[model samples]
Each structure stands twice: as structure tokens, then as C-alpha cells.
Target: MIPTLILLGLVFGRWWRSSLMAAAVGWPVVLVATDVMSIEVGLLGASALATMNAAVGVVVHQMILRMTRQLRPAGSSRSGA
Candidate 1:
């Protein structure tokens, strides 16, 4: 649930790569907290969390790349020379 929400936030914010990097850090923190707090039955394990982040990150990153266009290196032509 937390990962999903984070991913959603990333998609909505159009900051997918950053979000996934955030998630890569975020998910493990979540799992560790769960264990420390004795919480159980979460939506996903660590691997799932990473995969989800990657999948959503790809979509989100592409959209971000499309939307912002500022991410491209300055003065680099898109067309192959």
C-alpha cells in the first residue's frame, strides 16, 4: 500500500526516476519498520517492492522525459547525426 501510494505520487508528480530511487530506499525502510514493530501481512515483500518500483518507475520516467524535455542534455540534438 505504501509503495503503491508512493508510486502514484511519483506518477502524478512526474518524478518517476527520483521516486523509484526514493522507493528503493523507502521500501526496505518500510519492511524493516514492519519487522521492528511486529507488523505482519503486508502487501508485498522486499523483492516485490523493488519490482513494483522498477515497473512503475519505467512508465513514470518515460512520461517525465516526455513532459519535461529539460532532462535532455543541453545542446544535444534528438535526431541521430
Candidate 2:
């Protein structure tokens, strides 16, 4: 579940979208599987964790993109010379 959320963040490359996706997938389970008090506490706790993880994934995705851009030769074509 954690990895899936992170992957969602990486794929989406946006924190809000990733969080929404996580909530869409997770909220129903949390709502159905827990008691009232647990639902309240768990939703908050899970939301925070999911947001943090998604943020981390977004950071990682940005870093990878930056690194790839840096590594590529400037104005280079796909065909080797």
C-alpha cells in the first residue's frame, strides 16, 4: 500500500493528485473496516502519512528528472554521430 501510494505520486508528479488518489483508494477501506473512533483517528493519521510519502515521491521524481536532464548532452540528437 505504501509503495503503491509512492508510485502514484511518482507517476502523477503532483502532491495533491497523489493524495487524492490515495484517499480515493484507501478511505473506503478505512471507513468500512474500523470502529468510529478508530476511523476518525486513523483517517487523520493515514492522511498525514500518505501526504508525506507522496511528497517524498514527488521530490524523488523531480530529482530524477533533473538528473537525467543534467546527464544528457546539450542539443544532442538521438542518433549517435
Candidate 3:
């Protein structure tokens, strides 16, 4: 899920959009998995977990982007004129 979200975010060029998509994709799966396993997780608990997962995914994605940007030198494209 984290990888998918990050890839989609990169593809779409929008971090928040990817984050939202992660929540949309994750909610139903989590709910159904818990149901199938007969795990008693309430709505609030499931929602909280999903939210946290999305938040962490977004933060990690942003950190990677920041690090990549920092690695590039500022004058790389400029010719020695």
C-alpha cells in the first residue's frame, strides 16, 4: 500500500492526491479483512489505523522527494560562461 501510494503520487505529481487515494483504497480492504478474520475492530479504531498509515506514507514520500532535491547541485545546468 505504501509503495503503491508513493508510486501513484509520483505518477500523478500530487502528494495529497495520492494520500487521499491511499485512504480510499485502504478503508474497504481493512474493514473486510478484519471481518473475514473475525477480528473485533471498531469503526474508530480501523479509521485511526488507516489514517495513521496514510500519514506515514505521505511523510515518507515527501522526505524522499526532499532528499532527492537536496542531492542535486544548484548550478548543474549552467554552463561555465
lDDT of 2 by residue, 1-81 (tens): 578667766877645564556655575466557653354556777777766777677778888888988999899877976
User: Residue 41: error of model 2 in Å?
Assistant: 3.4
Output candidate 1 Cα RMSD: 7.3
Error of 3 at 56 (Å): 1.1
User: Where in model 1 is the C-alpha error above 4 Å?
Assistant: 1-13, 36-54, 57-81
Clash numbers, per candidate: 0, 0, 0
lDDT of 3 at 10: 48
Q: Model 1, residue 17: what's the lDDT?
A: 55
**Which pairs of residues clash in candidate 2, taking residues 3 or more apart in a chain or in different chains?**
none
Q: Which ten residues in a row have the lowest lDDT in candidate 2?
A: 31-40
> What clash pairs does model 1 have?
none
Alpha-carbon deviation at 12 in model 2, angstroms: 1.4
Candidate 3 lowest-lDDT run of ten: 5-14
Scored against the true structure, residue 37 in model 3 reaches a CA lDDT of 30
lDDT of each: 0.60, 0.67, 0.59
After aligning candidate 1 to the native by TM-score, how far in Å is the CA of 14 from where it should be?
1.2
Residue-level lDDT tens digits of model 1 in 1-81: 556744554564465555566666666676677774234445346535664656664676577777668777777887856
Ten-residue stretch with the least lDDT total in model 1? 36-45
In candidate 3, stretches whose alpha carbon ends up further than 4 angstroms from where it belongs are 1-14, 24-26, 37-41, 76-81
